[model samples]
Target: MAKEVYQNRIELLQGTLDLLILETLRWGAQHGYGISHAIRARSGEVLQVETGSLYPALHRLERQKWIASQWRLTEQNQRAKFYELTTAGKEQLVRDRSKWEAMVQAIAGVLGPVPEPEA
Candidate 1:
């Protein structure tokens, strides 16, 4: 059952990770673990952002100057790097969201409505 549930998860595309990370940071500054938790919670467990993918995205976003990070102690008193969106990141979020919405609409159009089940 757990394996089936795990298998149902969706894998994120290359650009989508950056968008999700930026949107997650929009709420406020968060450590890497916190960021992943927030995304999983918000996605209702359907989207699991793996650490392998998450860290590289974090580093890339940092290099892009879309987010800034600082070392901070978590609630558990453990030290971690917290990241927050920069002004440019906020702008990028807006742009990415627009593109995402448009892509969703385009895909939906191509797929059309779902067929009804037979009685």
Candidate 2:
């Protein structure tokens, strides 16, 4: 059987990833790869969370206090640092989610409904 190749072209805008990363932390503290997998799974494989992007975002969020990290052993027994959301992170998530929703709604209003083909 031929292996299926998945292409991920949806580029996440600057700072948008920070919001998603913070939200993912809300579930619980998770290591880098775990965070990537969680977002991909939650997004139903639509969003390809890349490690290159995710690591920097995680560090940025840590510096911003939206998340905090601590070194710990992974389920596989490897040492890794896990990140978790702080109180501020939760509050920020709510604000970000609202803003994103508004932006989406505004764009939808401008785009209008799709035209249906004649029967």
Candidate of highest TM-score:
1
lDDT tens per residue, model 2, 1-119 = 22322222233364578778888888899999998898899999988788888888888788889899999999999999999999988999999889888989989988998778899
> How far off is residue 81 in model 2, in Å?
0.5
Q: What is the lDDT of residue 24 in candidate 2?
A: 85
Local accuracy by lDDT, each model: 0.92, 0.84
lDDT of 1 by residue, 2-111 (tens): 87655544333667999999999999999999999999999999889999999999999999999999999999999999999999999999999999899899899889
Candidate 1 residues lying further than 4 Å off, grouped into runs, are 1-12, 114-119
| TM-score on alpha carbons, each prediction | 0.84, 0.81
Model 1 lDDT, residue 1, Cα:
89
Q: Superposing all C-alpha atoms, what RMSD in Å does each candidate have to the true structure?
A: 7.5, 8.5
Best by lDDT: 1
